[model samples]
Target: MYTGMRISEICNLKMVDIDLENRRISVVGKGNIYRRIPLREDVVYMMKEYVEQEREKSKFADSEYLIVTQRSAKMDRTAMLTWFWRLSAELGFRIYPHKFRHTFCTRLIQLGVPILTVSKLVGHSSPQMTARYYVKIGMNEKLHAIHLL
Candidate 1:
């Protein structure tokens, strides 16, 4: 969720795609386009740990993929969805991977991030596309707006 990458992009992530020192990742988005996304410090830290600890312990230690399984196989979208489903079942809530993209956009909008900036961050073709599809003004924001007067 830190990076608003598509599931396909996340699934295809390679270790080289991450620039931990730079605190960003390069992802291949829809239409095979590449984009760089900034990462939070915690996310970068966790990625480092995962690479140094978990990945090294796996049979796929030599694998180029960022995330791998015990069998040393690169994960696909189906595997990601299955994991999300299992986690949602355990947590007693509806959760899905794609929901994260929406949440990411929503959170950015809630923070008063401009649509143009958000669009660039999320790899939208234009601010109009981002505003038309992703931005959701809820009851809370509506109420808050009225009270601002």
Candidate 2:
């Protein structure tokens, strides 16, 4: 999911919408902006495995949904969060999923990814939103000024 897509966009994805050969998934993001997100090799592999498993047990073989419930219903954000929160509690992590999003941005900045790209990846409206979270952590002016003399 990290290749740059909003949760709603991902939830709307179908198997037919994915370009396996190109390793990209088309997403309809905020403002109805359509874009392709590159998939990591691991993500591609996992998706392939999931699809194959879904195919065998699926009563509706014609269903093109990328993800499905046991009854073959499309997944929604609320159910997704219910699962996430349940798993988080089981793992003893009391954090919200949004915290992971913030951590993702922070780690990307620390890894030297450009702020503009990170902003786009997170589906932020602008770089200013991204900066609001990371800029405080990047402050070193006070320490650097001591050496300027």
Best by TM-score: 1
lDDT string for model 1 (67-87, tens) is 898754698888889899999
Per-residue lDDT for 61-125 in model 2, tens only? Answer: 45666767656557677776887889989999775556567777877887888999888777777
RMSD of each: 2.2, 2.8
The models' CA-based lDDT, in order, is 0.87, 0.73
Candidate 2 accuracy as TM-score: 0.79
The C-alpha TM-scores of every prediction are 0.89, 0.79
The per-residue C-alpha lDDT of model 1 at residue 120 equals: 84
- Per-model tally of clashing residue pairs: 0, 0
- Most lDDT-accurate candidate: 1
